[model samples]
Target: MWELIQSNRRKSLILFFGMGALLILIGYVFGSYYDPEAGGVVGVFFAIVLWVILSALSYFAGSKILLAVSGAKEVTKDVHPQLYNVVEEMKIAAGVPFFPKIYIIDDPAPNAFATGVKPENSAIAVTSGLLSTLNRYELQGVVAHEMSHIVNRDILLMTFAGVMLGVITIMSDIFFRGMYFGGGSRYRSRSSSKSSGQAQVIVMILAIILAILGPVLAQLFYFAISRKREYLADASAARLTRYPEGLANALEKIANSTHKLRSANKVTAPMYIVNPLKREGMKLADLTSTHPPISERIKILRALQQGVSYNDYQRVFEMIHGKKEKIIPDSVLKESIAVTPVIGLTNEDKDFNPIEARREANDAVMKLNDYNFINCKCGVKIKIPPDYNKPIVVCPRCGTRHQLR
Candidate 1:
């Protein structure tokens, strides 16, 4: 496990510096494009400010912000006891130091994600669609997968990488907008030396090119690392649940779901267990995707026939890819411990009701948002809006009169 952590840290450092250098270079070029003087310093200052503000937010309030952005409401056992139990089981299995706070998003898209810079304090948020759709074993697989992200300490890396990518995009956008709006008109003059004029023109061309390519290069870097970490998280999920099929099935259902994740945006798409954004013609299963192809992930997981361990997943991964390239680092694989799948029905499964679960999900989110619930005698429940000023309400279904509390 230390080897895994160490490897991630090493990769994160390289990504940090590599992308940081690209960001600084873009700033210098664009700054020089506008003013060949100290404008470069001002440009760098702006970039730094944007990066620092976002970085600080990531370190301090990232988890909260992401959950809020996803419209997740904090939930207790009473709201969804099965989800609580699943998360607790995974927390113990993964040996995470703390029991992460749980949240439920109201969206019908079946997806989940983990966030927080440190393992000691973190959170796992899942959409209500996931809760209502997945069975206990399938849900356990997803929770374990999210738990792995916390244990492996890659949340910070992803967060900061996203921040850097955003900064580069913003810097490039500003430069291009300036050029389009006549900021580049002040670049050179006939009074300057011929050699100086030529140099200025060269800088302007380079600036334009950097502004165009900056976001694309940054996205590639971000997606490359994102895909690697995702594979690792999947392998860890199988290890923790000792049931590769569980996660494989979960992925299948998620991929098949038609319900769009209305809460997802471009920035938060990578944090999800699957890509939530729907591009018109983009094939997310391609090589440059933010996530490994769902079909490929399912195939590899389903191929693990022998044991449940990092080594087993690695063998399966290689077998499917027809190559020996390692997904889990060598040091970690050498020291891996194995577990067998726990079969049979869990207590939560016998009485599990998807309809009830769906209702619970909706009710819990409404309650958290301050909506009042009224139980009618005719089995119809009425939800009173928070802003309703009337002292009494009539049930739409039962036509029963109820007083607002």
Candidate 2:
């Protein structure tokens, strides 16, 4: 496990530096073609400065930005006690440095994601639909999965990659727009001679090609790492919770839901437990996907007959795909010790009622909005609106007087 963390840290560094280098490369190419003198060096300097600023923002404020983009609102334990308790349990189970703040997105998509550079500065967000759809055990499974991402440093790896990908896409769009508006023709006309003009044109062509391919390559880079990490987080969740079936059941429910997430975009979609953008047919080995197939993931979890360990997951992975290839590193697998699997809640106890879940979530939201809750001895729960402004409230069912506080 330590080896995997170290490896992820190494990958994060590589991604950060690789992005900075690419920015400098693009700036130099554009500057040299535009101004033949020392402009290329100046462009490189500007790119370096921009990269530092962007990297800082990515590390410091990326999670906040993501939350804002998803329209997620932070909630206190009082606002959603059940959800809060699940996060707390998973945080302790995963042995993270701190409990991540919780956020809720009021969307109908049954999906969740984690963000931040490290465990101490992390947050886990779930769609309101997710809260309304999953049972307590299923929610625990999802929360554990997200917590394991924090434990495994997947957030840092994917966040940096996302930052780089965004930079490339922005730079590419600016370059193409400049070319579309006669910036290239103007530069060509400014050349000293026909030979110089032709040379400049060739550089421009190369720059254009680079600009076109740069974001695609970065995106592919992100997807390559992301898919593997999802699998790893799944395995880690099973081991942490000691109930692979919980997650397996959760995955099946999430996959079966047809609700589409309204706030999901390409940049934020990969961070989700399941790919919000994926349609029905994408497979685990799909190169373009940021997640393994839900079916394959569930199968691997169910196949962990011995126990939830890296060795068990790796064996199942290879068996399911019919190859002896390694998913967990040799050192990590050797170090991983399986524990006895524990029985989970029965199907009768685990049965999720979506209507009840939805009502609970709505009631929580109302409470957060300052609606007063009154409990009657007659087993009636009354919610008084803020505008009611009544000194005393009478329970319609039991005729009990309850003070509105």
Candidate 3:
């Protein structure tokens, strides 16, 4: 598993640097096509600047941006202590320095994701639906999956890659728009230098092709990397929780769920534990798909009988497929040991009720939106709508008149 992680890190670094270099090349070609004198150098410099700016944004403000886009609100432990406690437990299991902040989205879609530049800066956000749908142990399984992502350094790599993909998309759009608007004049500029005309035309042609296909290639690579990491995270989650069935059950629920996450988009969808926007007929090994098939994932988790380790998962994967594909590094497999199974949840977890959590999440969202709560003397709590115009209110249960104002 450690070797697998190292391999992932190495591949990620290569992809990041490779994509960055491509962006720089695109910038140079773009600049040279227009100005033959210093345009190429200026373009490279500009690309570097843009890359730096985007990387910084992804590192510093990326989590905040994602939270805001997902309509996630930071939740306090006092509000959702059960969720907080689960996160803390997983944090300890992952051996992170501190507990990642927790956020809740108002959407009823049963999905969750983790994000940040590093473990110390990480955060986990889950939909209100997830809280309402999953029991204590099930929720722990999901949280553990996300914790594994953070501890495994998938967050940083994915976030940076996503940002780089964004840059490529933007640059591609700009190039195409420039071509559509005034490409002929730019091409004619090359005629000013006869000695370099052929070279200039070749560079321009390559630039156009790259700009056209850069985003597509980058996105394909991004999805491929993301899918690989998802498998790794699943194995790590099972290892951390020592209860493979819990996560398997959770995955089943998530996969069968019909609710679509409203806040999910193409860019953010890959960050989720499962693809929030799934298409019909998508297979586990689809190169274009951002996640492995949920059925396949659940199968892998359920097949683990020996213990929750990478070697166990690999063995099951190969057995289930009747193939000898290696998912874990050879070095890690030889050194792998059995992990103790987690028998069950603690007392606090046993006390967690999904129904109550759903009600609590609903009430929290309502309160945040200016709904007023009134505890009546007749053992009934009434929620008053924010826009209610009447001055008086009566408890439906007790017929007691209350002042609305």
Highest TM-score: give the candidate number: 2
* Model 2 worst lDDT window (10 residues): 182-191
**Which regions in candidate 1 have their CA more than 4 angstroms from the true location?**
183-187, 279-285, 342-353, 359-363, 366-405
lDDT of 1 by residue, 1-405 (tens): 678899889888999999989988888787777778776887777788889998998889988888888888888876677889999999888775698999988888899999889887789999989987888788998998899998888898899899999899888888878888885747566327788777788988898889888899999989888888889999999988888888988888898999999999888989999988853224544556788788889999888767878988888888887877767887898888876655544454557688887777777777767787777999987888799999999988878888776
Model 2, residue 251: distance off in Å is 1.5
Rank candidates, TM-score, best first: 2, 1, 3
Q: For candidate 2, what is the TM-score?
A: 0.91
Per-residue C-alpha lDDT of model 2 across residues 1-91, encoded as one tens digit per residue:
5877986787788877887678778878766656655657876776667666887998999899999999888888977889999999987
TM-score per candidate, chains pooled: 0.86, 0.91, 0.84
- Comparing 1 and 3 on lDDT, the stronger one: 1
RMSD of each: 4.3, 2.5, 4.3
In model 3, the clashing pairs are none
**Backbone clash count, each prediction separately:** 0, 0, 0
Regarding lDDT, does 1 or 2 come out ahead? 1
Enumerate residue pairs that collide in model 2. none
- Model 2 stretches astray by more than 4 angstroms: 183-201, 283-285, 323-326, 344-355
